[model samples]
Target: MFKLLLRRFFSLTLPLALICAAGFGLDWSALALADQAPPGAQIFELHCAGCHIHGGNIVRRNKTLKLKALQRNGMDNLTAISEIVLNGKGNMSAYQDRLTEAEIQSVAAYVLEQAEQGWK
Candidate 1:
């Protein structure tokens, strides 16, 4: 009886311990939280606001995120903006590794929306 109980305990716990050691046993709450993607404005604030505050570029005056500049630079659409956010352009850093595809798209949409709104 003692040996059977000990064997059952090891059988149940060994795989769990192994899974945790392998980093598969993530916290359920953390996983749930990670499953939720942040909104576009939040993402933009966290990543792009420093350089492109209020849709204005601090580095290059001509390459601002405003409607006029975006239209002139051929970045007036979501695809163009998303591509730039993923691959980056001059004076802008790429966020392909730091953000997911959906996040990039969200921020791109946010930029276009804000541009249309005149950043108000």
Candidate 2:
């Protein structure tokens, strides 16, 4: 009877452990970890700075966006900014495929936390 119970326990535990491992693997794959810098700053440098200008650099002939303008424009929160980065707007191109949801959220958080505070 004890042997049968032990076998049953192993049977259940083995699959459960495998499932958990698989879930973790899937999560790791889903999370984007490409940015070596802050996510928001990286996103801006890669996507926005090209045309909007940033950090005292003028790469294009467009108007620059300061922190205040970014917050007032609804990028004050991570969720809103994430959607914008993922979907893109106006003349901006979408980064949905280029960045994962995690990357978007991280970048959005960084922008809101560091940039918005200075805007006020």
Candidate 3:
């Protein structure tokens, strides 16, 4: 009986522990600890939420992050949005220095995604 129980424990608990460790239960590597880039939503919250809460632009109400507004303003695509984010336009300040290229792209993609989803 003890032998059977021990075999069950090894087969089940050991594999579960290993799986959990692989899934962050024991991830202490420097690569894991290295600063991972914040997601688009987080970036938006930190840098744009103050001015563009819920995709509504307080500075330029007409130029919101909404899909319709983006389309109407010739910013319906990722390239256009990325350009604005990289260089800024009108009331918006450039984020070229504040964010890495990847981050800018991520934020741009996030904006497009949120816009497509109606910012809900």
Cα displacement (angstroms), candidate 1, residue 110, comes to: 0.3
Better of 2 and 3 by lDDT: 3
For this target, which candidate reaches the highest lDDT against the unseen true structure?
1
The CA lDDT of each predicted structure is 0.93, 0.66, 0.90
Q: Write the per-residue lDDT of candidate 1 for residues 1-120, one digit (tens) a residue.
A: 999999999999999897885697557777576556468988998899999999999988899999999999999999999999999988899999999999999999999999999998
Per-candidate total of colliding backbone pairs: 0, 2, 0
Cα lDDT over the full model 3: 0.90
Comparing 1 with 2 on lDDT, the higher-scoring candidate is 1
- TM-score of every prediction relative to native: 0.68, 0.50, 0.68
After superposition, the stretches of candidate 3 with alpha carbons farther than 4 Å from their true spots are: 1-38
**Model 3 per-residue lDDT tens digits across residues 8-120:** 98999988888887897575675454445458877898898899999999998899999999999999999999999999999999999999999899999999999999999
